[model samples]
Target chain A: MRHSSGFRAFRAIGLLVFAAYFFIPLLAMFDFSTQVRGSAEGRTWDNWAFMVTDEDLRSSIVASLLLAVFTVVLMVVLLVPTMVWVRLRVPRARALIEFLCLLPLTIPALVIVVGITNVYSWVTYLLGDSALVLTFAYVVLVLPYSYRAIDASLSGIDAATLSEAARSLGAGWFTVIVRIIMPNITGGILGAAFIAVALVLGEYVFASLLHFDTLPVAMAALYKSNGPAAMAAALASMILVAVLLVGLTFLSRDRHKQGASS
Target chain B: MVGAFQDENGALTLGNLDALTSEAALTALKGSLILSASTAIIGALLGALLAYLIVSMPPQSLMRRSTLAVSGVLAQFGGVVLAFAWIATIGPVGVLTKAMDDLVGANIYGSGWLFGLPGLVVVYCYFQIPLMVIVFAPAFEGLRPQWREAAVNLGASTWDYWRHVALPLLLPAFLGALLLLFANAFAAYATAAVLVSQGQPIVPLMIRQAITSEVLLGQANVGFALALEMIVVVTLVMVAYNVLLRRTARWMR
Candidate 1:
């Protein structure tokens, strides 16, 4: 493949400019967050250090971290089994399930929040207004992404044969889903979970509008008095999300390897 | 949403929709349309260009994989954090604004346009471009070299090959990605909520106001109708996306 010099130059310049455009603001955030607020002084660790010591910010991060864990668990548990069941037993329902899952994409979070705010008056009365209650909605929020990722994995693997193999060996439905099918599709499940976690971390609408005071909300609140510290938290959250995204790419890629065998 | 259509007596009525056609509601809707459409056009084109640039790189290159992975995260990047970054860049006392002031002796934020639609387009583009890349990058990779090679062997020039073959094949996917991008910007709430504080010039902000801000007796229902209006718009976009996706899948898959 002989590449022309002009074409190569164009790609290099194009990518460089786009990368700069995308990465510069992120870099600017890093730069601004490090510098002392209100004074033109050299960079300091005051804000980044505040991430650990600031009680409210720390609590918010911890709360969001817990929510992310719960959201991922609920998404996998609820979706993977239902998806496996649909694939193995009632394949015709796949389209309906898919449409239902992807419906959240078209329906904005604000609309869902409007319905939930109206509906969850009862839910709050019953369960109390705990941030953990936000997890239930978070699962629905992540469904479109999770379902697509999991479905791609299901498609890549011969899920039916794997399930049949377990069943013929006298495995029950639970064993089939938990032991046989899940292992084969662990890559996809992990990928979906990673993305779910990232989405939950940076989520603001449902949390802020619903008044859940998640990490993003906490950061926004902090922005009024502490600009640098808020950016620090934002930087930290973005890094965590970036790592998860990288992990997801690797996990999905790993699926291709196992996909050949199954 | 039923609450939005309810009357003063809590009786259901279409009067809340009358509010939907109000000057304020219409302004917010117009603001949303302007922001989302412009972001979609600029973001989709920028992303397509970047996707092409990445695809031009060697597949196994570390740069290619890392860029793709980072794009995935950055595409999902929005909300309060994104607003923070933009403020740091262009807001009063912002780094770039200060630097430009020092060098060019011009105050960029002096006009205070950063709080309105112009600043929003710039801020929104940050996520929009990356999102477009995440959506459209795969489409770029799906282009087979053989198509170009075969076209060339058939005596077609590069322009003819791209215009006749590549453009037709890629158009649906491009449109699909663009629509998703539109729906994304249209439905977005947090960034605008944080940045545009003068007034809620967007529907998402309007919904928030209806729900949270100065609670009038009937504004809640009006808010609900506004939410419905947003959903109706996004549904049309999604339906269009589905059609385009089906068309894309036929050729791309």
Candidate 2:
């Protein structure tokens, strides 16, 4: 397509506007995290120090990490085989399965928290309340993203050919999936795992509603108590997300390279 | 767990679940539906406009790269930070609020639509626009130049071309984006909780209150009931969206 100077100028303006919109808030958060007192003063590390020193803060961070790990494991176990089966055996129902996987996207986390709390309250009355209910909710919450990554990966392979090849080698259905498909889609699994972790780490509504002490909940509690320290926690959370996003981007780039080379 | 359901209160039965439905709860449900639907419509329109404008511009590699980066950031920025930024800009003590109050002797802070429903719709629009762009931009890119030229050659008017050809192709993407926008808006709590007043509570806020009060006061059964209600509603929405996505994608096969 041909271009004019007017078009170029308009493009530049649009880019700048969106860029500012995106970056300004993040920069403000970072500024708030470092700033001493209520206002944005000269740079200081006191907020960071406070965030690190607080015991509940540390525990919340650890709990968030555990939740993320649990979510990733659960998502992989459920989604990997489902994606493989849909692609290889149930192609007709692939769309149906995909829709089922993405259903969580439509349901708000807050609503899910509410619903599960009700069901679990009955269970808690019987089983006694545990963090297990919260973990189950996290699995449902991360389902949409996890399914997407795994589905995309499964679609990338020749499912029929691979299954046929494994069958000819006298491998059992389970063994073929475990030994062949699993190794082939490691990239997708990793990407999906990271995405799940990111969602779990940042989740606030579910954790808060369930009365579990995740990092975001802990931060919200602290925000009510100490503004600066909470800001520091928020900044740390953003940084954690940024790092995960960067890693995912790199993995995506590598996948693209492999795709192109092959 | 099964036995817990057997426990009963005097003169209160499972058949009386209807009694729990009150005017206040009904009002909140109605408000949530209205707010979510309106925001999704307005957001999708504004987003499509923005997407169209951006894609129509002559493609520069750097421009495309930067746009993706920016969109990624904006799409992911949710929760407290989103609420805080908007509040800082336009809340009661916000820069514009204080300025308007001082300059015009009219208190704009917490006094008008900007702080309540109107303000929420605007912020929701902000969140929705970028997401719409992210989802719809790829659809726009997938439109081959040959298709548009083909439409022009057929003597189809510009509006007719868009209405017939471009729209049919774009329908799946547009619906998918709209569904996503609706879900995000519907599910949203942190933004609304911080931005809106307690007198006008959303479903999530009500749930939060129920949980906290029940836990603190040891009213577990009531909280359980409320949570069950929320789960049922959310599950229905999820199922509806799933059906929509399947129906839309059926044509692609």
Candidate 3:
């Protein structure tokens, strides 16, 4: 554990280099967002205010937030029970389930947007023209990440034994999943939900290509006429996502420490 | 979607592949490959170094934990937000550019190449490096200090210990992380889409063009074909990554 001065210096310099690379642009975003337009040396809040004041941008922001909520709800509803049941009853299909969940990682979202045109035509025809239909695709997008999070927590508990005991005591499948297994994986569920929210907020390809106005698509559109406003929006969302992810990291880390102590 | 790859008679054919051979398509493909490969190499090297530094710190240290938390955030930080981040830093009227002009009397912002391939590489590396750190750090953790101590006690100098004992063990994991970064950069669409608006400097932009501005009626089919092409390339890279991961897991476990 003894370190030479040279190695210590190397490590210090390396950290400083990375710190600069990462932090400078963020600081620049803050500076850029507040710069007074058509003025030489003053700051203004108009760009930041435009986020709420502009009708198009404000609606897109609302749409994106709703998409995040629906995506989280859909992801949890669809994935949690399937993952838990597979781990319990159909252990034989665990590999297949995992592979399916992780398939989106290999298939880019662009490919999905390209191929889903046919499917979305039916979906749009049936559901009417609304952006919320994107909830289905967003669920698919977050599957691999949320699956890993939920699966880790699922594996950490004795799901089979707990469910068996519940079954023996006359608790139905719904009760077992909702009351028992869900409580145990709340940390993972929260982690997955935070990630999903962050991702859905920043998603652009699907919204832009599909002609649905979302936060990022709106930011891109705003960037054309109002660069400062778009930069402000981008910085704001980036900070929001950073807060969510950093919080998730702390949550998972605390859970790990608790698990280790126990 | 698969129908895009078929001929008029509904038979699967290489007719769509003809679209890829066009001058613009080839340029975009070349640009994509070059961008992905360069970013992978740079990200792998720098991110490995950063990971090594963080791993050497005490596990409970705030610096180590925060670096990891920040890396997790940054790794997922891509798309239009990322493009705006860089522009805010170095765009024509950006903060740093303005500050430098005022204070240092030096205009570092040239003819705005940040809207092109060089800029794309810089922006992509911002995310790619953090992703590399996230994926490669576990490999660094897998290297038990006792192994290094054992090598040292057995007459290995610092360089000798790293060269002979560490490098060989880390190579497979390093390559695996490199491939993962490569695929990450390759599949990235949003940043390029936002940053480079005028021309199709990359395949993702080309795909965007095919989708949005269908000069011809069936041009969207070319986008489908290109998506298929992206799927094949990413699938192959991931398969190789999985193989390397299995190798890493053997000794790592």
Candidate 4:
């Protein structure tokens, strides 16, 4: 159980090297975003201020966030029940759902964007270019991740027994999924939601190619006018995801600890 | 694409596959392969090292838990946001470049190579390394401490233990993560699109160009062909990954 001093030192150095590699760029971004350009006046909130003042950027941030909210809701609703149902009721179809969920991983984003461009014409014609319609594709993009996380959580629970237990108590099918299975997989669902938020926030190609004014697309567009400000927006977005990621870690960590103990 | 396989006279032929064989296509393929290969190799090595570190850590420790938590998100961190993160550090007007200019009278972002392969690799590795951890760590957890105790009981030193037991166990997992990373980097679109926008440095960008600016009318289908090629690469990589995963599962058992 004792780690040798040399081994400990090696571990420390390796972690340190990677931590620096990981953190420095983000730290630099924070510094760059705050610094006043062409002024002797040191750091300022100018870029952050610009994010508030720039109407388009402001709107894009809001729009993207709203889209994230919708996307996460969509993902949970669409995936959670289907995955749970397949496990409990139609275990034979489990493979089908798994393949469908993981289909996006094999198909490149470019191809998806290309193939879906045809469909989006109909989507936009029906829904208009409000950028919210991008949520459908975002759900597909998040499917593999969300499915994996939720499935892992589901695996930890005896789904059939739990469903049977709930059903024997006169719980309806919907109630079994919503009340029982949902509470059980909260950790996994949150983990999946965190990933969805990160993916939707930084999502670029689908948003840009589809002509949606999401935050990343806006950041790229804003880069031409104010590089530092765009970088600032990026830093803020990273910070948001980092916070979400931290939250996710805590959620899953609690579940992991519970899992190990139980 | 029908156009890609068509003859010069517009009759369907094997000639369009030549579009992929041209110097530009070859260069982009080479660029994609080199970048993806390096990303996979480097990501697998560093990520496996990190994974090993986590597996060694006290399971209840914050370090291991935090690493898993952070690695989950960081692995997925790529595309436009990633490009800007690097630019903020090392872009032409980036903080580091400016600092170096002030400190040593040299500009790091000079010559503009960051807009090319080297920069792409650095940015790509940001996500690739952590992804390797996410993909590889679970397999590492399969190493039973009882095996180590049993190995030691059998008079095996640590080096001998790894040589005979650990390395063989981890090799399939390491290679599996490597292939996944390869496909991950290869199919990536936004990072390169945002970083190196002008030229066709990789397949994804080439496809984007073909669709957006097909010089000839039928050349549009060429873009679809390129996308198909990317999907083929991804399919092969996933197949290899599934095979490795089965191999890993057996050893774990």
C-alpha lDDT score of every prediction, in listed order:
0.86, 0.70, 0.89, 0.84
Model 1 alpha-carbon drift over 4 Å, by segment: A168-170, A260-262, B1-14
Predicted complex 2: CAPRI docking category: acceptable
Q: What is the TM-score (0 to 1) of candidate 4?
A: 0.90
List pairs with backbone clashes in candidate 2. A114-B227, A115-B231
lDDT of 3 by residue, B1-253 (tens): 2342233213115367789889999999999999999999999999999999999888888999889989999999999988988898988887788889999899878888899999888889999999989999999899999999899899999899999999999999999999999999998999999899799988888888987884667777788778878888898999999999899889887
Local accuracy of candidate 2 as per-residue lDDT tens digits, B124-166: 7767878888877877877888888899899988799899999
Of 2 and 4, the candidate ranking higher by TM-score: 4
Over A1-262, each residue of candidate 1 has an lDDT whose tens digit, in order, gives 5689999998888888877777777888998899887866787999999989999989899999999999999999999999998988899999999988987877888888877776566667889988888888899999999999889878877888888888899999999889888887777788888889999999999998888878999999999999999999999998898888878888777766665776
Among all windows of 10 consecutive residues in model 1 chain B, the one with the lowest summed lDDT is B3-12
**Candidate closest to the true structure, highest lDDT:** 3
Model 4 residue B171 lDDT? 90
Best TM-score among the predictions, by candidate number:
3
User: Candidate 1: TM of chain A?
Assistant: 0.94
Tens-digit per-residue lDDT, A1-262, candidate 4: 7899999999999899999888888888888778776535687888998999999999999999999999999999999989987887799999988988888877777778866766678889998779899999899999998999999999999989988998999999999989999998888998899989988998888897778999999999898778779988998898898888888777776887798898
Q: TM-score-based ranking, best first?
A: 3, 1, 4, 2
Structure candidate 3, residue pairs in collision: none
Here the TM-score of candidate 1's chain B is 0.93
Chain A TM-score per candidate? 0.94, 0.87, 0.97, 0.91
